[model samples]
Target: MIHAGVYYTPGSLKARFCLAGNQATKTFCDQNNICYDTCGKMLVATSELEMTRMRALWERTAANGLEREWLSAAELREREPNIIGLGGIFVPSSGIVRYRDIATAMANRFQAKGGEIIYHADVSALTEHAAGVIIRTSRGQEIETATLIGCAGLMADRLVKMLGVDPGFIICPFRGEYFRLAPEHNRIVNHLIYPIPDPAMPFLGVHLTRMIDGSVTVGPNAVLALKREGYRKRDISFADTLEILRSPGIRRVLQNHLLSGLNEMKNSLCKSGYLRRVQKYCPSLTANDLQPWPAGVRAQAVSPDGKLIDDFLFVATPRSIHTCNAPSPAATSAIPIGAHIVSKVQALRESQINPGRTLRAARSVDVLHAAFTR
Candidate 1:
């Protein structure tokens, strides 16, 4: 999904990158002959409180320089007959595409440019020195490089710790479970429908999304996962569980969000309860309309003091840089994010060449292409 820089703090990495990425991604798709849909999206408000929040969000998005249209109840109903709301906001620049396809295209392009990708090699350890970083795989293979950029999503903290850096945070896995609407109801809504989200929470409330293939998906209630990669309710990892239980940060998070977390769990276990959330705006949906769909795990970084890192976070050392936290819209903002990382790497290389003097010959530096597993 392409985000229009809404719902993020102004001047934050997320807002800046998302705004740039919205255009960059579409341009890339155009150049590569990839298919996408700028079908637009709507944030619907079901109650008076939500209406007030929606107005505030409209102002925020405007501050971010996004084009939007405020919709009254009549206008919303005219656009989506099946959706009921007190009011809504229409963002024309928001869109959707298959990110898997984009990733594959990028990998193909990288390989064509002499980049190598190694699979199934899990990195076991990392050692940083004045020269560079030494990466050791589980299979006992060692790779030496002049620079290392760790984009490890779920294992970001562990990778930092392997480099002997104090991460000051832990990754807490939250499973977002989705349900695909039955095919018969595919055209129920003309645009992506969302709810006015709680400002205090990181997770967006349950909403309906129209996929590139024309199917609508409902859900994604955020619930704590027992395993980092857990996709099913039955999947559990004792090691992951033990670590979560021992973390003071995780304990604080649980304490602060106890009620909401319990409600999410209850909905996850009870199909009827889950249906009620979407029913608030899209009442035409029933329990039977929800079909089983694949789930996704989010790697959320929580500070030692229990605050969720709501913006993009990066930590750098002399020889290495780590993307510590990249929350929602990361996929949409990938292009700009990559460009930002590359710029940082170039700056690091220049700094190493001359401590006090700026190096103008950036193109002369040879960036080594190395792969580390996991």
Candidate 2:
């Protein structure tokens, strides 16, 4: 199954840690000959509340055998001359990778193993039986196989619904707009400069990131997206918009985050408002330094009761598994996650084992096969 990399990965959904995530990505890159940078990452804190949270993060990571440092305001200024904040948690190993390059390598490896890949194959239907599963694609193709799995990214929730499982969540698209710092302003930040995120919210807030090419990027304020595949602010699909509007659960969430939603929309529309978000930590940026970059859509899983699904959630059947909620850190933890899923499939094949019992007891994973299949 193809995994959705970084962007689809959520905001502290799986873990409120970046070092572990980055380290995991770095490890994958090293083992696969994928090129990546180790520019490190910094999460700056301004208020006493942020400072206290930073300290807690430092201690928690340290206890987990992770390397982290608590830096002073002056120290932060020395390393990042433009950074303005009280202090921050510095994770030296946190860096960025060329996502495309990593994805290409993985695809090549998959094909090299004699695995057939059908690009642009839109799965339209699924039928499961005691013998096997039949998958129908929009391109007028069909395949029968012993087992089936789905990793349809933004369309995962819909695809899972076709398989007869509710999965207890819906995919709500969130648009995150970004800006590349002008060439001259690239030196303004030495590492990834992130403002401490609100513990109550999933978003990490706006921060400056140094891509693998050494260019600084800022502002990825999250806003509701009208289309799942929409890449531009104006791009919209009437069907997608209608589907989202009809969901009462989604409406409840919008009401819950009313002010926050409006603020994000403001930042998305106003360049200065977006810049001010990053300016909280990086004071050197001017509106002129904001260069245009393509925006990304996040497939955020929202529960039926108006809560964000904040972990790796997988719903399964006798012969198939569907990823319901897998946000950030997924790219970094791909290898381990794949291994974990493989174990679940293996557990199901035991003749004497109760499939439901096997799935539930399989490493604490949330298996919905028994709930749905029964």
Candidate 3:
């Protein structure tokens, strides 16, 4: 819920989960009449060589079961007349939604089915024993679960450490700042428009996105977050800053990607630089056009060796299952992810108990019911 889109690699846990999430999102929206749009996406090629790169991306998308069509510059112009590009690859399936609403809907369905979700009850500690895992919160409240599945978002790394498992990585927060286009420019785009991403970096570059609510937003420039939940430029936490700076893994990672890191820092500091990124697709914009919105922090996992964890990392032992990293597109894939987790947990439970008639009868909704209360 807290992490963003970097915890994935092609054909990785993140990729697989995201693929499942994509389909699951469409289905959930259809079933619940939620406002969702697969308004499609386009990766604009700004140059001839970039056109080839877009082709390669098309191939990757096909492998991932994403249907896409190559669009010539003229065709791209037809779709987004306000935008200009050398050429582009049109992915008709990629779309956007209000994640906040989607989350509320999911929580509602989960609880209506007898599932209990205690929001704001953040778990601070977990102790494993012969019978189950004892979870303790900051308020000293405790709950015993036959198993503990940690999806502790921004604090995932810290939670993993609390469980005494060192994945040898630290969570480095990258804040993505966004700008909503002025109402007059809402007609600028009909689909999600993205710049061809730099393969060397995790970010896919700035683009134009049309939310389900009938507004267009631009930006989401990557910047190093001074605080984990820091949404504003002025927001900073001394303790968090100290923690990141003191982290050897973070230092090494930054050192390794010094150029890209420096560029990102520059963009964050220079409004012109950030505007230039958004202007690639929307040329009509000027400095005054950029408007601030709540920024989302990407809880990027970095290793001591300076490598970012580019795949969905699931660390499972006989005792517990920890979702080390689940970021964006995660909201889109929450249902399938939840179902997959439920299946694995059931399999583990079945290994311990006999497959009896009543247990078999309850198989459909029983474990899912247990998860609600736990």
Candidate 4:
């Protein structure tokens, strides 16, 4: 995932963790001889209002310790003559790498460091014991651990509920529908190209991404998925649909964001509307150049008050720490985020060992638990 820089608030967990994650990823890639490019990214503004907003974006990047350079219309044209812009922000620190490969490398490193990962072992249930965490898998095998840390992406909220914690949100899957440009048009964009997002929304707006493989991918229109794991249209599971509709949090979120959500839903169905989003910046892209590509589902945590959780949220009970909401830029920030989680769990473990001396620390754990219920 591209670290778009502005989705996270300054000094927030998402911001710090993502900045750290970006640095860690680069170090890992360099050490492992992985191919990556620090080609940077440009957020182009075509209108007068958007140009004014570009200053705020620049300030945000600087506050986050990211290196960014602003470009005038003439300068932007010099950088990419084919692209048109009234103003823009050029982020030098932004870049690209293959996430699947990074996951593989991380898995290997985790195993080498004595971290065990059992594949295909879907967790069926979780029971907290006095001594440790007892995890029951679908295969009927029970495993015990001194402490449990859950990074279960899509199933996070359900896992929290299974542990008897009342998470105030529900996991709603939003599928990102993407299309790849044909080989002939691959040279159209030499770097990442983006449009200034709506100031009121959480989404970064549709943008162009240059993959490490030298292919260009456009779009990723957000649409509510019929299934949590749905990769294509019409892929639905009754249980998944029921789980969403049954949740009061999700219902309220939908009720509140109905207008914006309906627009996304419309784009999902109307190819013409979807294409218009692309045509806004890249006038040269025609519907014929858009081709099917593998899609990814984003597990968004929706609150009962109709708000989407945009930052990283964590909940800790005596037995486990649940990551309820980790959206886009998560993959970019996973390394530091993982380290942060490990630190929290370690701190909790230390408190458990010396409850008398670490009374305050113990209380902090309880606070986390209470937060989960609230």
Candidate 5:
């Protein structure tokens, strides 16, 4: 991401946007001079059985100050001329931004503030002691820090293991493949189009998104990957593959979602099967209109009990704090997450910095941890 610059156009918007952290994300956009669409609309296309649940979501959030409305079938078509669906929840505050640009901007600012940016410095080991935290990089370089935080995405679990902290969660990579709409079809969706996510499934079925480039991209059906860093359909790692198959975590996930797993695999193999998901709501799209787009791999954290970790989980030591699981919305909450970590670091008494706080087990859903006061 630090190397790729051109790919960061028209920021990344996904299935849905939340009223939470919307402001912080926008703040990032403004600071970077990144152009973004604020009045972002994301449509949650629903199945017949999902209407009740969708209605509750709208009811719960509508009163929170943002414009939330239950659009009727007629209303959906009337408002979005290209959409064809029964109806869904409409969130007007949802939006999209160039995430890479935001990251680059943050890096530039960090450097300006006396922060060093080191490229290709993959950490091979981390050790905490009275002297501080010692980091050994893969390039055979050693660096020590007064404090260290781990935000490694796909490799977070492995890195935490090096520091010898385990929260009973393992990261399982699920590759999401997306297809671009031909320029002719780009005008089809004016807002973000999302399928009502199944409560039982870890991944939302395929959805449509309006990128900042005035292009529409569809798909991102979740499929198990053979490697954690593998972004392509065929990219595989023998070691990572073996590790995943042998893990109790992956086994439990497979046992619980056998049919769902197979269906996702099918969607990945057959283009028609994948297209049918998009067709469910956007009937106007045809196979010919689909083009190639880069796919994303999500580092989904799963516990030994077959449940996906839906919330961000953190583990802390005296000299270190590790973000074991942070994916989607993590990008949205980058500012606050950084601030929260800094606050915690600042509050640490020099004497207590070694043992720090015991990492209690808690489900971190939407909110950041309370202010870490001295």
Candidate 6:
């Protein structure tokens, strides 16, 4: 889903990038002939408490300079009869597209520009020197590069550690489980329906979404996963589980969010429990309406003190830059994120070449520009 930058704090990287990315993604889609839906989004409030939160969210959207409209309960019903709510905030710029299509298009473009993507090259080690960095893969292949940008999603922290850098955080996997509504209920809603999220929590509450394929999807409840790649309940890696358990940060996280974590686990196990969460706003849905859909695991970064890193985080060495934490909206903000990384890489390269030169000075000399052009 392409976010409209409604929920992010103003002046943060998320807000800046997401807003820019919303437009960039659409432009890219247009240029690539990729189909997408600017179906919009509604944050529905089911209770007075939620309504209050909804108002705060509305103010936040304004602060973020997003295009939004306040929807009265009657207006909300008029727009989406299937959704029940006290009130809602409609964001017109929110949209949906097949991210896989975008990724594939990007890969094709990269290859067309003489870039190579080696599949199944599991990086085993990284050795950095004054000249460059040497990367060794599990398949016994070694590649040396003048600069390395590590965007390993789940293994970001590990990549930093492989470079002999202390990441100061660990990656905790959170499984977001979804269920596709029955085809018969495809017209359940006209737009993506979201709940007024709790400000304290990072995960947005389970809500209904209108997919680009003309199907409605419900869910994406965040549950702590035992394995980094664990999508199924039974999929557990002993090493992953052991590592998670051993983390002082995760233990602190469990201690703080024990009740909420247990509630998520309960909802995951009990279909009825999960149903109840969405039923508050989408009362028409029942167990029979839900069908299995593929689940996705989020790579959430947590600090040593158990604080969930809610912003885009990057760690830099003289020769490398590691994207340590970037969760939701990262995909939506991919274009700007990539540009941001490129700028960082340029600055790092310049600093290495001329120790006393600032980025502005180096850019004036066109040192990195010459290197790239060469």
List candidate 6 segments past 4 Å from native: 357-374
Each prediction's whole-model lDDT (CA): 0.87, 0.72, 0.71, 0.78, 0.71, 0.88
Q: Candidate 1 residues 270-372, lDDT tens each?
A: 9999999999999988899999999999999998898888888777777887787887889888887787777768767887887784433111112221321
Model 5, span 36-84: residue lDDT tens: 7854554555477777656655654544445666788889888778777
Top-lDDT structure, candidate number: 6
Q: How many backbone overlaps does candidate 5 show? A: 3
Please list the residue runs of candidate 2 whose C-alpha ends up more than 4 Å from where it truly belongs after superposition: 1-13, 16-24, 351-374
TM-score of each: 0.94, 0.88, 0.88, 0.92, 0.88, 0.95
Model 3 reaches what TM-score against the true structure?
0.88
TM-score top scorer: 6
TM-score of 4: 0.92
Evaluate residue 223 in candidate 2 and report its C-alpha lDDT on the 0 to 100 scale: 92
Model 5 residue runs over 4 Å out of place are 1-20, 62-66, 349-374
lDDT of candidate 6 at residue 211, scale 0 to 100 = 84
The reply for model 1, stretches above 4 Å from the true place, is 355-374
Candidate 2 residue pairs that clash: 9-327, 9-328, 10-327, 10-328
TM-score of candidate 1 against the unseen true structure: 0.94
Which whole-number lDDT from 0 to 100 does residue 196 have in model 4? 85
**Stretches of candidate 4 exceeding 4 Å from the true structure:** 2-4, 357-374
Candidate 1 vs candidate 5, lDDT winner: 1
On a 0 to 100 scale, what is the lDDT of residue 225 in model 6? 90
**What would the per-residue lDDT of candidate 2 be over residues 1-374, giving only the tens digit for each residue?**
01112222223324422323455566667888877767777779988999987876676556544567788999888887888889977776666778888778778888999978898988889997755579999999999987676666799888877867666778999988989989988678778777877766768788787776768788678899999888789989999999999987788889988889999998888898998887777776789989999888888888889888777777777667666666666666555556555655665555225534433211125322232110
